[model samples]
Target: MRITKTLWNKASAARLLLYKRDASPPSNAVRVLGAMLGLQFDFEEPDLLQMEHRTPEYRKINPMATIPVLKDGDFTLAESHAINLYLLSKYGGEQKEVLYPSDLKTRAVIDQCLFFDAGMLFRRLLEVSQPAFIGKIDSASSTHIRNIEEGYGIVETYLESSPYVAGDRLTLADISLGCTVAGLEGINIQ
Candidate 1:
């Protein structure tokens, strides 16, 4: 829980659009941001904006109509990945080296994992698990099970190689996949 010393010391206003869940992926993003910036999040679970990204009022904050929008001072950002990176770069010091990396080759490996999580791993999990979470998709269906299984197999294969997804040292990639993918285990997906 060692957050950024300078970031914690600075007085800043922070707000996030998110839901209530222990393992909510966005919360992990916020947690990572807090760790990166060393600042406590002024979290607000705005009911009016809850999943109402298309509303005109909400569009002012993020025209893309995305959840987990972040507002700090005059700046606003959307996309958890982008926000996490921004926080780390702008506020983090030596710790940024661990999360984002300094070496080109090591950074590439982390980038690969982040890309896989955002582009493929998470997409598939959300597709199959969406139904299960919302009671729309039958969790026991062979197709649903297979989809989850396939995704899990892919992650497990990679995890078998390293203690974490991106390798020995934990990175943003682990934070992303760990919170999102690991939650699927509730339905025995893992």
Candidate 2:
């Protein structure tokens, strides 16, 4: 099923299709960022547990079979980080531009932080989660807990100098990292 929204400016507005998971932190980040930018998008939720994302129809949209896929008109893209960057670049106005600065240095820092979240923080969480999802483990092991703690320590150090992850101002890095960190709630890592 698909739900479309007609924005205020139809001529300039592009139809956005977002494949998301309701409980997914990455998906939540995309939804929050879109709302902040005042961009309307259609949403489709595919059940990963039920293997819905593995179906032919879903695979056609994203060969990687990942949630948080974004389709703008005919252009399809997977990965939440890439989607957030594209959305901001395409729809962000002057006021919204601060979220992802045009300055080369600032943009680089934001990109670095975003990569850290993807490669380090979120990766650690997934290591713990994927095993539990398939009944490989009843709970996180000592090593998994240590890894999560180490990731948190890195985040804490990064936050020491600024309120947000990248810097003082809110950026795509913050949205991405914030959502990834929020996923730690349900896990018994404590």
Candidate 3:
């Protein structure tokens, strides 16, 4: 059933630390980072098949109606990318310098990879999955398949530049794309 309550607000009640309904790729990326940071989350499983994210309560946590809303203390943030970066910056402790170092040039490279993942790679994956998920098609079309190849071409270029997308050492960029690439593979991108 669709959530009809329109008066619910995030400000009224907020004690949740983390809300992840499943092991979706986006949430998994953050989960990987959280594991590296040795952090434990307060998980609550909800049926995505039932569209729980469309509920008023879930919307209060993430207006985008997405999974894996991070609520650490008074800070309530949505979006896995933002949540991952914030967690690394705030709670990374010693691992902060290694995973997401504050260096200028390295950080720029990491940022580039993140942007590429968010814009091109992830978008291409969505083109295929969204339609299939809604029963618009049985599988990805040739156009969507070509788009996925184009995304992989970009990945190839990044790998050619260095062993990792960001450089020698693994960074948050790799984690983001790792999850996205896994999604792409789910749609047979590879």
Candidate 4:
């Protein structure tokens, strides 16, 4: 992704806030998409270990107090998947058509991929992470490992038919799912 002068200028002027860090897969996805769109965002890192997300102010912005919150002016949105979709729909021009197509069937497939990431891949990851973070477990259980491997198996099957997750071209689905896989890798979950 080459950053053009126009993109740089637009990014400099945009007022966007992304509450995220590199350690989080969903956060990483949104950051990549924002960069692709030439959108600059003020990053606010909420320390989960420090309980910063539990603060009253942060909770007001997001009741769930999750990371990767997007604040565009007065409008605030939670969840990285939704934020990615919103960013593409609002700022993506004709040049970004491959990232998100307008055709109903194609879009539906992309949507399904997004849901799969959220419901299956990320959900299984959370099962492993949540326990470790709260000191419930020192390592991933056999069940947790099996679930993640199954998720990857599904992704492997999907890739057999297309160069990317959803189709031949890169889409928001790839961004979303890629981040989740990257997160798992970062922790040496395999």
Best by lDDT: 4
Q: What's the number of clashes in each of the models?
A: 2, 0, 0, 0
Where in model 4 is the C-alpha error above 4 Å? 1-14
**CA RMSD per model (angstroms):** 4.0, 3.6, 8.5, 3.0
Higher-ranked by lDDT: 3 or 4: 4
In model 3, what is the error at residue 24, expressed in angstroms? 2.0
Query: Candidate 3's residue-wise lDDT over 112-168, tens digit each?
Result: 988888778888887777677767888777889888898999988989979998899
Candidate 1 stretches greater than 4 Å from native: 1-23, 46-51, 132-135, 138-140, 188-190
Itemize residue pairs with steric clashes in candidate 2. none
Judged by whole-model lDDT over C-alpha atoms, candidate 1 comes out at 0.67
lDDT of 1 by residue, 69-100 (tens): 66666678877777777777766667799888
Question: TM-score, each model?
Answer: 0.78, 0.90, 0.85, 0.90
Q: What lDDT does each candidate get?
A: 0.67, 0.83, 0.78, 0.85
What is candidate 2's lDDT per residue for 1-190, written digit by digit as tens?
Answer: 4433326313356678899977788888898888887677788888888889999988898888888999888899998998998887777766346998888988899989989988898889888887887788889999999999999999999899899888889899989888888887668754
